[model samples]
Target: MKSGDAARLMGWDTTRLSRILRGTYRVSADDVRTFCGKLGVDDPAGVEEVARVAEEPIGEGWWAAYASRIGQNYLDFIELEAEAQTLRIQHPVIVPGLLQSPGYVREMITRAPTAVSPAHAEMLVSIRLARQAVLSTATKLHALVPESALHAKFESGPAIMRDQIRKLLDASQMTNVELQLLPLTAHPTYGSIGAITVLSYKHPWANVASVDNALGGNHIDDPQQVSFLEKEFAAIAEIALPVDKSREVLDEYLEGLRK
Candidate 1:
């Protein structure tokens, strides 16, 4: 149970175990088995439970098939997202991937300045579409997108954005989904940081947040940092329009798209 003993059992340097404990690093299935054994949880039932959970696929059929295509870093959050009871997202310049229409996704992908091969682009679009399945059931989706995100143009033009807006409105109407928008003139602090999506769960270990950027993404598990991110989201949420008016907000943008 001691730190040094636990490290010795795992054949890890103390700092390495620290990273796993702090969630700055991830663990392999073998690591899970070893840890369970070392921590006095090796009863047959306990061991089986741990093994089953560690081995269980986060995304069953197709999600598992595309495992290699996903970045391990992003996949880490995806695993949590699949089990999370609630998802909170803040997108500054685009629709949240979970709510994007196929046309919008295709537009954003094929037209990105950083060109990808046609085959690869189509694959990415499929992955995005598949991710929407994770929202099955009454899983609550709370979204806060800025007005600027809605106004941004894609190479596919107004129609793509129109479809995106329509899809977003449909999602907002779902019983378990809530949507809001941060006006362009709201306080600039959170917008400067970039997009964030937080996955919350009943268990603390399953809680995490993902931050996206030009380079890649970050998985934030440090309790204090995650708390700060949650607070920042709250601050922006306060500045956002009330949830009831979200449909009006998206519809307003859709009307502009038609003009």
Candidate 2:
């Protein structure tokens, strides 16, 4: 099967299917029934679950405080990230946002073409940093970053890269964190596709993949597409350095940056 056949079978692009599965779509009982049949499951109760999610008013989350500052696309990720038990990430460009230092994050935001106002940028930074709270919680995070991302110098400049590398090293020490470095030779295959974060929860909710691009991207929950992305991620991880070796790679890069 080609990469997008599952989306074709689902009769929608992965992004739209993702919205439906993520409950962002106006999920009618009829739609739910149809999906249940398609998935070969009997799930009228699933329709009711969708109905509840649609009509039930939600209380304020901490992100609510920065809703204006945080873009809706990221807010969507935040919503799912909060409930996820595990976060498996493939970062090809830079450090994953959750693991980024405040300075690094600020540099990233300020460099954006949209050019946020000073105060507005600070609010967004707070939300981004606040997201690190998930790290201290029960969420188990696994990040596979290529050596190039470690080597990539951004507007935050050398200092931030060093700080970021130090942070990556520190995070690798965390019991719940699994950080690996994909070598340059692996770039043509796994790393070239850029970043994707797979979030796992308990059953029925299943897994969601948030595919990132130059612009913000969509949240996907289609079973087959999620499975495909998972396999792709696994392939990348396979080529990546093991834990100790990943650290060794990091040390080598960090030392190179110092010289």
The CA lDDT at 171 in model 2 is 91
Model 2: what TM-score? 0.74
For candidate 1, the 10 contiguous residues with the lowest summed lDDT are 49-58
TM-scores for the candidates: 0.78, 0.74
CA lDDT, candidate 1, residue 180: 88
The residue pairs in collision within model 2 are: none
Question: Residues 1-259, candidate 2, lDDT per residue (tens digit)?
Answer: 4425545765778787777656676655565666656666766666556545555456477877666755688888888898799999987777789888777888887777887688887877888888889999889999987676666667546888888888888899999999998877774867666688999985456899999865567889899999988998999888888999888777876787423
Regions of candidate 1 where Cα sits further than 4 Å from its true position: 3-61, 204-206, 257-259
lDDT of each: 0.78, 0.79
Question: Measured by TM-score, how close is model 1 to the native structure?
Answer: 0.78
Clash number for candidate 1? 0
Candidate closest to the true structure, highest lDDT: 2
